[model samples]
Target: MVIIIFHFFLIYSAAAVGLAPPSTYLDGCQPMSCKRGAPSVRFPFQLKGRQNESCGSPGFNLSCNNKNQTVLELPKSVKLLVKRIDYVKQMIQVYAEDGCVQRQLPNLTLSSSPFEFMSDYYSFDSTYKNFSLFKCAGEGWSHYGSYYTIGCLSREPGSYVKYTSSDYPNTDLFHCSRTMDLREVPEGLISDESNNLYFNWSRPECGDCEARHQGCRRNDTKPSGFECFVIPIKHMGTRTKLMISGISIGSFFLALSLSVVLYMHHLHKKEKDAQGKIEQFLEDYKALKPSRYSYADIKRITFDFKEKLGQGGYGTVFKGTLSNDVSVAVKLLNNFKGNGEEFINEVSSMGRIHHVNVTRLVGFCADGYHRALVYEYLPNESLEKFIFGDKGENHFLGWEKLHEIALGIAKGIEYLHQGCEQRILHFDIKPHNILLDQHFNPKISDFGLAKLCSKEQSAVSMTAARGTMGYIAPEVLSRNFGNVSYKSDVYSFGMMLLEMVGGRKNIDVKVEHMSQVYFPEWVYNRLDKGEALGMSIENEEHDKIAKKLTIVGLWCIQWYPVDRPSMKSVVQMLEGEVEHLTVPPNPFASKEEMRAKLPINRELPTISE
Candidate 1:
């Protein structure tokens, strides 16, 4: 009778808390297996934009890149590719997306994110590395072979830095740029080849609970936040002890009551906000030319979302046939976040675009937040499904085809940046976003993250970081790299091009041994040393295509936004001879401290609509 009463109380508590039965509500945290070599994701770590936020603790949200790699975005806009997550040890192993650890050190503060240095009740695998960064004028320390040489600081002309082990300078500092000491990092973590780093965080130890097949969560009634509720039958002993210590049934009931009210309120506010945002967007995009379709029309066109095409950060795609016998892809966006900026962006930007390389926006539907976009259906899917997929019989696109695809993507980007009346910067340009037609021609798609600005404007403003982890330019992640501009898109394109050349992700931890996980840096090292491009060369033409793509990609991904060439230059470089094309400076070699000044233009209106 007592057991039955206890079970009834639990059910009542769960209902009062507005939670599904434990089997359902807690199922979100079930270990998730990634397609690639990424580690299984579980408690305290959830894939952002995919898994529910409640599945993970605050500051533990992660994102999966198009390449199926898991990434963690830290404060100060640093993104580290997750190599491993040791649940028992509560440690996470990560490698810098770019091999430059020094560049990420300045922003590696723990205050903004939940992650903390080893000093904060956690232990690290290695000791900290202390290095000195010296800024000198005109490469005075050029003769020093031992020093890590960073090129001229962009802000201060004729100033260069010799990154070294000691704070004491061996030579005179007469012609030096401003020098600073980097944060003490794990020893050997900032070396020329250093790419992997580790961080640990304190979370409730739930291994025993998990072993016993029970769910664990924080004991919110506790003040220190260290206590947990090991759920189901396994934690009965702990519950008995807590009950004896005056953890009243009433307090738990009260918490459940409050949580229910708060959750309902949150849901109400979220729906209200989403509706208002959509309404405001409709008002702003009233001038948009894409004909708006009703929700019934969307259902008719999409045939009730039956034939699925693909999925992405924003939504899912389905195949549809129009009244005119034209095949179309209808994208139905998820409405839970972002204030409808992505929906407005697609309709406003792609509706006005007309180019063979750019995806044609056929129409849209925004009836009561049933947001969907219709586009001309290409027979072939995205370039990612072709190039980055497992090398099966159908996955291979030969070098000539790959080269043609690369050139087509370049032209599409150039058209967007230069040909548009108001230059549209497609912030997210990865293989997944690039669609291919039956003839294997490439078309730029997914303008949801696109930003618009006048042709004369040098840069656009942003409230938060946008774009995928591996492809985001240094500047877009943090202002310290340089001003965000069209060059940011170039950086993304460069990464994609490199992926095409390597026939793999640029940062594949499984293949690249040692600190050579960052493929761009590895390529730079080989190219600088005049090593054979390190690819399986079928013939002279294949070698030339690989070399050309590698060189152009290197040039496009220069660390500073200013150092990267415009899309127009990238196109020319791609078309030029492989021998004529010079390998760009190692993007990860050294940091460009100073940036060139550009004439500031009037601030453009916010792209809220």
Candidate 2:
């Protein structure tokens, strides 16, 4: 069946290559600019009024303002004036129209756009340094020459705003009070002069063409892709054209035949190796007593895979029913690229856990190449739907229910880390993995990235970092923070707790104000100032519950793993009164120190589960 599909794909490719002729419009798409000295926009960057859509890549559209200045609008409505574009280097120099890019730094996010900060692209580091913003009384602080004053945020009443990159600034010396921390701007890009930000694009890659002084255009064979072509000369001889055509046709067939043979051989070898590993794993764990079903049984239970509960990188989950009339969620492992390691991990960790807060593994199917795991169905679904859906959904849960849910999740994580004989570390602990029952009780699910170690073991060995981004602990990404231990799970839980309090994602780029972009940091600053948490607080009791959760979350997310509390301590803190809870030290304080530890050009191993 696989070979037949491959043959069809090969035939389709051949037809596509034959049908797609070279585009004749390249000569018409000449470079244009808003005015003299303005950056010339060409291929991959189209001038909106002057060029057609086919002339440039998607999301690379540029426009000219009334002042005849080249303008580029990034995601979230950030507009910058284009100063210069280096096509060979694939970099763009842009600055805010107001001449102060620092004013827009908080809301400036490039993740959704095709461009990336030049410093980030070169350094291979996504971490940002925290710049402490201070509002000082009186404007005659020229003695503190190291600090730069933000003219836009400064006031006329003998007060001005100054910022320093130092994590611990001497506030008394400058006679200033810390207002907030700016983390979006990189240390290398921040300057007192004109805020010229350099950004480079990796897509519509034409560096090779630019180096050779050739033309690049969209690949006609694949519209979503790109291709480089040689510059055409006027009036080619017929003999030269015939010779070139013959050579290209001959080479195309030769390469296609070779690729087909090699691909088939590679697929056969991979399937044999994967099957062998599965068989060995099953033999090793056969003594464990979960009912193993055949492929036919899985089909019948899922009613021919009709209803899909969810789909992820690993596989698709279907809603199913057992012979005993019990409902179950069957996850069919369709994209099994690993050597049965994730299958082994899930079964090994979940088969032994029986806590009320943990999801139950009822049965599994390992028939031939088909593999699936059946879990008890939770009618209320995941906690993510309720918390992040809408204002109405959040109101339904209320502050009290959110507090209770937080405690239940903490207890569940505690059980995974300690209740069982072997310490089970759930590498992924986001809100999506936490399922809620009809009674709204939380159950931890998804053990594909779980690790098992003896309770006596202080840390576990890891070949690669696991878990979803934004929730992964510092140590898991780099060992400079600490060892990969149960504390990693604690860090992830802390992030989720903060997310629950804000009723939004922890790293929200769509926030209206720059200061609120990083929700956790913003929450910490608000709490530190002894101000109202800006959340939906109807009364003082709800306020107390929110503060307690926030404090516990802050404590759990401390920069160093040693500073974070254990799951056991986390549960106690959650259960304790808000008055007894104390706010943790700023987690963003040591970002500069930790950023130095990240090695450049270090390739993280691919996690294939």
Candidate 3:
């Protein structure tokens, strides 16, 4: 029979006590086989068929529950449900099943196994099945245990802790309990079985571990299956057990005390850390609060949403009157989407970049889930309405006023992209994004995708493409499309310019010849042919402004991101001669129609893109 000793070494090891041995294994068991149907007890563990003894160390011990099947009290702290234990490589595979993803994220427990394979003895077969080391979200997150699976797998945090079975009924894998993660093994040295664990030990199995060998255990620790130098147990010293029991009680009490002290110390440190985090959070979140407004205030302002002003991707806009009888446009931010970020973006940038041509963010509302923004009403609405709408708002503005509107818009955008301390790239810059005030002056608005750049950086990486499809620059969709830079905004503005001249969406796909006419291509043909620059406005000067805008806009919409002009140059061109305009190469013609926009050479491993 093999006697295994169970030893637990944690602060709470006393409460989780195991029966230590007074002597090593003394009798009655048969030799075990690797294929034995009895039960597989791998390295760092062993089991006596009948006789019971402690295993390896004072703490690395485990025992079969009443069934002599289910392994529990593993490392004395966690319960391990053993399936098949492999001895060739030291590991015990256990199952960790949680129902859903969100559920797994929070309370999922760690792998309940101890008895790690020594670094010198075993190394995980990493390349075998695509199983790599476990990674955490970051410093605040925890690493679950390393897993030896047929393939790579994702596991919850709290499953990996370097220290184990240092205490009774548990191990040294202490967790940060409802706090920071505590599951990082200094490195990925220790790996647990995905489902079936295996272990590698010194040359001989327990049978050969006789006279000179020690420390080899199967299920329990030293006294039971511990392999060590053989010493003769000569006499059975008997005795009075009373004094010994009292000493044992005193030791147990002492162990219990040490655990409490350590636990308290951990909590104190966490409290101090939390205090610092709160202060930092308050400072950052101070200016991010959504604007506040009352439903009654909304009713009075929007005139009960009466004017029937307009509807957009977000919500309805109504011209209204405030208590001071101030005329304002109340945008009842939609209930379905969270666009309050636009409110924040506008307010933050507007406060920093003050310009008369820029629409000011007056105030906002974040009531329950309801959000809204209040701004001084621009009775003229937007350029898109008059220029593109079926209605006759276009008849009201003659050529010179239209030219002024165009100049004002160009100045506002140029200021955002260059004049401000931070070069703000207004990603969404189209007719709809441009609002006009009472004096027929234009103010750039809607900066939901604005990217802030220092004087140092003028370019940035783009992810999934954004902005209106017709207005999106090629570089935004893929690097092969071109290098992404502030010029992408130039592309959108160009599309808007053509629309202002054509009196509708540039690429209509509606009028057959003009439908697929591809605005950029059509604009170039008209300018090169020099037949009135091909567009006619009711007012003659409107024709020149329209022609000038069309040529400059075509130049801005060039295919390569680099081929586009800076907003400063755009303002210059708008103010400059039509003859000075250099024609920009058109990259959107057959190339876009023929091939996939992105390069095929870059093979992204594992990423679905």
Instruction: Please give each candidate's TM-score.
Output: 0.50, 0.50, 0.46
Per-residue lDDT of 38 in model 1: 70
Q: Give the Cα lDDT of each candidate.
A: 0.75, 0.81, 0.58
How do the residues 1-609 of candidate 2 rate in per-residue lDDT, one tens digit apiece? 446445655665565445444434445776689998888787789899998888888878799999999998886678888988888888888878877777766665666678877653244334457787778888644436568777767756889888887666455544778887766556655553547677888888888888998777766586648777776644546875665566556655655676677778889999999999999889756634466789899999999999999998789999999888999999998645787777778888999888789998887888878889989999888999988966554435888888989999999999998899988999999999999998899999999899888787768878899999999998899876767788889999999999999989998898899999999999999999998889889998999999999999999998777778999999999898989988887888767865564455323222222
lDDT string, candidate 1, 1-609, tens digits: 344445555665555444222233334455564565679776677777767776777788788887788888887677888888877667787776666555776666545666544422255434555566767656344446556564332235566566666654545545654467665554344543445566777665655555665555544566644333344322235555555334346645555666666677878999999999999888757634577789899889988888998886688899998898889999999988689989989988998888899998989999996899999899988888776757454577888899989999999999999998999999999998899999989999999999888888778888889999899998888876666788889999999998888777888887738656888888878879979867778998998898899999998888777778889988888888888887676677533333233223423233331
Best by lDDT: 2
Q: lDDT order of candidates, best first?
A: 2, 1, 3
Question: What is the TM-score (0 to 1) of candidate 1?
Answer: 0.50
Model 3 regions lying over 4 Å from their true place: 1-296, 303-306, 389-396, 512-516, 537-544, 587-609
Model 3 is weakest, by summed lDDT over 10 consecutive residues, at 1-10
Model 1 is weakest, by summed lDDT over 10 consecutive residues, at 595-604
Per-residue error at 57 for model 2, in Å?
A: 99
- Model 2 clash tally? 0
